[model samples]
Target: MFQLVSTIVIRRLLVAIPTLLLLSLVVFVVLRLLPVDPLAMMLPPSATAADSAALRQQMGMDKPIPVQFLIWLWDAARGSLGNSINFRQPVVGLMVTALPATIELAVVGLVLALMISIPGGVIAYVLYKRKRETAADLVVTLLQSIPSFLWSLLLILVFGVLWPVVPFSGRVGQEVTLPGITGFAMIDLLVTGQFQAWLSALSHLFLPALALALSFAPLVIRVLRSGLIDAANEPYVEVARLRGLSETRILWRHMLKNAALPTITMIGVQFGFLFGGALLVEMIFGFPGLGNLMVQAVRGNDLPLIQGISLIFCVLMLAITVVVDVLYALLNPKLRNL
Candidate 1:
């Protein structure tokens, strides 16, 4: 098992390295090709020619694009992601501040999605077996039809405007200040024994997280229901039935385990979408996260910040893919042979 796991890890790393390199090159080139002038955006209108030249030289924008990319790549390799022109801070520092919030939000959203989707999937599968799948199918379609941003807007209108049950915008209420130990508001608040602040954070988190969950849960339900239905038709299911196993036992003991494999894989794939969706949701909810940072970078034409954030996102996606592959292999031993 150790050897197999080692092989999988090595193989995934081999693929990921080249993929990351290619993606970095592409991002660098694309950002350079954009028509907006970073220097113009950053400099004051009263700045003279010498000022422009000096700033350009300082940022290495005076160099050829290829040379600029090489220098940036070298600096990145040496753990310097360059300064954000907009924020006027180190890109690394900005990411450190923003990434944890994004992670916290995404994780909460994913957990909520799983909480909703797993039971939904089982119920849908049961309905499928009973040939009464209309209601389940309708719910899936309704959820899937609306994009996450629309869900965010609707959630805000209903939960934020109409009922006003929870705090709809921000990570925590301004009055609830906790020391940033882990950078995660909820964890930091809890660690400081700020139970009231923690509750405020949870309240602020719910709408955006629910938007993400609603957007993500439909696909999970569909995938899991399909996997269960397929598992139900397998020969082992027949044997379990022949052995006088109750339908519930056969499903819980036999079908769920196998069906979960594909569901897990689907969840892994959907996590990327969840991150993408979180960007918009964060924007709508005024949540400070990488998505919000990226948007600011773009608006201000902060190429360095954009490149850093894009590379981080690419790396995260690759890491998630590797983890999913490893999990898939662990759960299905037959993959070890490959």
Candidate 2:
């Protein structure tokens, strides 16, 4: 089992290297080709041509495109993702501060999504068996049709404004000063015994996470429902029924175990979309995540920061894909042989 898992990890990493290289190259080339100059935003309006030239030289932007890319790549290989022209900080540093926040948000959102989706799927399957699937279908349709940003708005108005149940903006309240241990607020707060701050963080996190959950859960519900329906018709399920297993046991222990394979795969696949959706949701809630950083980078034409964030996102997606493949192999032992 260990060997199989190791082999899969090795194989996936081997494939990921070239994929990341190609993606980085594409992102580098495309960003350079844009007509807008990074220095335009970096320099003052009264700056001279000489000032522009000197600044370009200082930043190594005066070099040829290929040379610039090579230099950037070299710098990136050494873990220095170059400096953000706008923020005037190391891109890696900026990402370090922001990425964890985004990750925490994404993870919480995914958890909430699964929490809602899995039961909803099981219920929908039970309803399908009773010929009452239309209600489930209606609910799923309504949830999926609305975009995440709109959900964010509605959540804000209902929970943040109308009832004032939860804090809508920011990761923590102003009075809560958390030590930056893991960059994850909740984790850091808990570890440091700041229970009050942790509660504040969770309160702020709920609405944005729910908005993400609302957007992502519907698809998982549909996929799991379909998987359950298919698994129910399998010959093994029939045999289990004949063996005098209760319908509930057959559904939970047998059917759900089989159905979960596809549902897990779907969850992994949808995670990329969830990450993207979190960006918009993050912006709506004033969450200081990568999405907000990316927006700032774009507005200021911070080439290095933009490129770094783009590459990081690509890497994250690839990592998620690799994780999904490993999980798939674990669930279905047949793939280990392949």
TM-score of each: 0.96, 0.97
lDDT of 2 by residue, 1-338 (tens): 67777887899899989988898889888998998889887789999999999999999988898899989989999999899989889999999999999999999999999999989999998899465677779889999999999999999999888999899999999999979998999999999999999999999999999999999999999999899999989999999999999999999998888888998888887898988998889899999999999999988988899999999998898888878878888888577566
Could you tell me which 10 consecutive residues in candidate 2 have the lowest summed lDDT?
Answer: 129-138
For candidate 1, the TM-score is 0.96
Q: In model 2, which regions exceed 4 Å deviation? A: 129-131, 336-338
Clashing pairs in 2: none
Q: What's the true lDDT of residue 295 in model 1?
A: 93
**Strongest candidate by TM-score:** 2
What is candidate 1's lDDT per residue for 1-338, written digit by digit as tens?
77777887899899988887888899999999999888787778899999999999998998998999899889989999999988889999999999999999999999999999989999999898465688779879999999989999999899779988898888899897759898999889888899998999999988899899999999999999999999988999999999999999999888988998999898988799999999999999999999999999989999999999999998888888888888888888587666
Model 2 lDDT, full chain set: 0.91
